[model samples]
Target: MDWRPWLTRWSEEWIGCTAPDELDPDVVRDGWLGFAPASPEAVAAAEERLGTGLPPSYREFLLTTDGWRDAGCFVSRMSDTSTLDWVRDLEPYWQDWEEPDDEEGDAEGGPISRGLLISLEADAGILFLDPGDVDESGEWAAYSLFSWLAEPPTRFPSFIALMESLYAEFHEMRRPEGATRDSWEAQVEEARRHALAGDIDAAEPVLAKAEDFGLSRATVLRAQILLLIGRTYEAEQLLGRLLHPSFTPDGFFADPLFAEEFLPLLFAEHARSSSPGHNSILQSALIGDPPELQLIIAEHQARLRRGAARATYGNPEFDDLVHAALERHATDPDALWRAVGEALPRWRPRSTDHIAPVALLTHPVLADTLTPERGRALLSQPRGDHR
Candidate 1:
């Protein structure tokens, strides 16, 4: 970065060490970081490999200077400082970034990811980046930081101590001379950071037992582990109260509600085992908010449409239906299958594999009237084209 004069001054004064006149020229150079956004040249190079231009938004992220986060090695004492994670994906943009002058090739700067990513290894730890040198992808990786050095262990700061230190820091920040409301909020935020980091052992007593503590939120989060292990009985025991009155089912479960596994488990017991109005259950849960589960159901419906030829339909939650559909769709005879995108509640994305296609042949209109070739003709043309 040409802004080195001020950086050197600041680093020297604050870091208590000499700062280089320039960023290591090797940190971001030739476009090597895997999964990183690509520059125009890098994109041109990748086109040679993948055989297509990247999606425009992805391309713009790699080339435009909107400052998105980049992934890289984060070595820093400040656990809360997102610089390390920010730079993990952001380093390429930081170094390769240039401003375009003309459309051809006279650009002064290139694209930046989404944000400026600065990785500060611990306060006392030395930054191990090679300035601007890059791997094949044009950015640095966390592994290179260790591989480049014969002795990288010395650079590995005591992560546990650092975490404990953060806990202590927030403990202090939350309680200044007098405990004001804002201080209480700050304390909870720090606790939340620790909880997200899975510091249950450290956060339990202080967060769960404190008078103005964050027990409710913490409980819902901690219960996630139970949900993950398929111990829904236990998880439900922990979160069941909220389904009734504690955290407001709308807000407490908002996040996990969109998650494929957890959401199903949280409401598995509640969904009607045998019912119809339940179709609208998806509606109410998504009121003001959108229904993401609707996609899962629609996907299942898609699979049913593709799996049947004689209007043969059945349950999905049931195992027999699941196996039958799987086999039928595997050798689907009908060539006319309709792929539709039903509106979802929360827009949760699922893979095509899990979201198996349904059989339109099962629909009476097609099964009762149209033959396979006619169905094929129907499939070839979009409904809008015919209309």
Candidate 2:
């Protein structure tokens, strides 16, 4: 198939504009994101060195753009025609299963031969053509090898077919829906870096700019910033809008920004809230803490089930103790109770002891496991009285 025109159009449409000097070795020697067509002489030299004619589509691709950067997957710049020495460089590493295996004394069984065609440095993998696995047109079968997997190589029909598959996958990752300008994406990335570094002051301004452009990701980041600064009410309100059914109707929960960043903040804020009603807001919104935290809470409730437990509950420092107790008491209920008993001696006489523990007991996981009688009994325990 005439792949040159198609490749050119794809490059222009997806890869964006290219300068005339982009193809110059000096220009792209450091790095580049697109392609530069090679001379016919250069292609001929590579073919002569490999002793196999390049696949028709790949050959045409080179005629249009000699090598590309990140064509698909983690593939770096394809080897320019002049630097086609990877074939020779990788010969020693190739296992010739055609011959008998001297170590195992087995002629038929051993590591199979893999003809390496392209090496992807960042991905730690290679694209190869297997002579033994050819197609009707005499094109070699293409395969991919990765150092991370012990299984057999993944196979494809031809180089062009492999490229096509990679392109499709790359497009999916770009999230073409509601596409934004490259500049907008860059601004969002910069904002995220600031947010991650705990510099909300710096991040908010940049995110505001991206939000002005209607970038949904920027909204998510802003929600994260709000949560970080202890603005749970505002964060949840914004998230409700950004993640509303009408706004992100299709993949609201599945968006990585939501799942990885926003959701965790929501769960943590719920965990930290002093008001049972405020904490319940998350449950009413159908948001739950992660399973690990839920499991820890369940175990804590089990200990509370055993007997009366003591904890200092009326101060800000007690919040830290509540978080710590939830994590520390799985098998050693005695230690947890002892820690709480130790804190009680320092508790002020008028301080409310029931609030934090009662709040915890009312968590959905715990509340569901305990009968109403049992829950009320645990809530009535007078362990916090110093007398």
Candidate 3:
């Protein structure tokens, strides 16, 4: 099938919609959608470098657009003709595969049976054309190779079939509303897919695009990406903004998917930081009466209690007392206060010198519940029965 015309039309539409002038120049440059078709010379050079004839369909794609982005394959960006240096780029991964033991009789001709890497996925997977697996037409079989998989390569009949399948998936993801072609929501969704695929770098540009467009969910997604990459401090800062009063609670926390997937990580990072600002943010997140926020609050407090116990006593079970109280009286302010009151005597001294309870009390949810006198009583109460 001649994919060039369809690919060209799609690429132009995608670039026209998504790559606004306000985006970072570097992002616009690196994004394959914004690139032009490769020169014939460049294509010839790449074929020569790989020492293999280029697949007709992919060669035509290069003529249409030198490289491409967000093709809906595992690959985040397809390589341009000049940059298709599989030998140099994939040699290390190819070498890393171990040779089969001699007793196994080299069933698949051992680790040397590697292919020509055509594109790179975010998780280090490669889409390659295996010369050894070519068809009668001399078209190589395309394989999706992953480092961790012990099974044989995922095979495609030809590069044309692979490109066609990816294009179909990409086309389906497009919305019916033309105005939303470059919408922040679309960008956010793209970033989410990249993040879920462990492609943090690929996700960043799209996230920045979302942020530039002032999408509410962008901050939450950024925090999620940051958390995934171990940038906890940055993640906490972003979450602080996300949970801030100015943003509507439903804007972020109301989504069950976000709440379930990201809230725990946000709360955990805030709890770990022990930052005053984070505690204030946590208080803000819990200030409302929404059932969703309430559940998140309970879970956050429970996590803190458990984390405190682990840090102080090397056993998370110590948090069970506090957990039981919160779980039993979650909806009743007075009853919850009493539960905290009862558990206070047992929890205070051990935790007072610690940061956990101090941080927890700073939040409005617990602050309004505990009076100065009650707090003092709990502090002065003997640790005898509690210990």
Candidate 2 lDDT over 1-387, as tens digits, reads: 576655544454344333445444543453334456778888898988877677666677677766666665566566667655433256445453233542265432332343645543437666666555567776666666655665456778987777766665554344333234466678777766554433556667887656554566676667645543445466577666664433442444554334333444455446766374564434544454445334534554476588645432334464456446556863455555445444433332222111113233323333233343433333233333313
lDDT score for residue 169 of model 2: 50
Off by over 4 Å in 1: 1-185, 210-215, 226-234, 249-261, 267-387
Global Cα lDDT for candidate 2? 0.52
Residue pairs clashing, model 3:
none
The runs of at least 3 residues in candidate 2 whose Cα sits more than 4 Å from the true structure, single-residue gaps closed, are 8-34, 85-88, 94-114, 177-387
Winner on TM-score between 2 and 3 is 2
Best by TM-score: 2
The better-scoring model by TM-score among 1 and 2 is 2
Model 2 is weakest, by summed lDDT over 10 consecutive residues, at: 347-356
Evaluated at residue 141, the lDDT of candidate 1 is 23
Q: Give me candidate 2's TM-score against the actual structure.
A: 0.39
Q: Is candidate 1 or candidate 2 better by lDDT?
A: 2
Candidate that beats the other on lDDT, 2 or 3, i.e. the better one: 3
lDDT of 3: 0.55
- TM-score against native, each model: 0.23, 0.39, 0.37
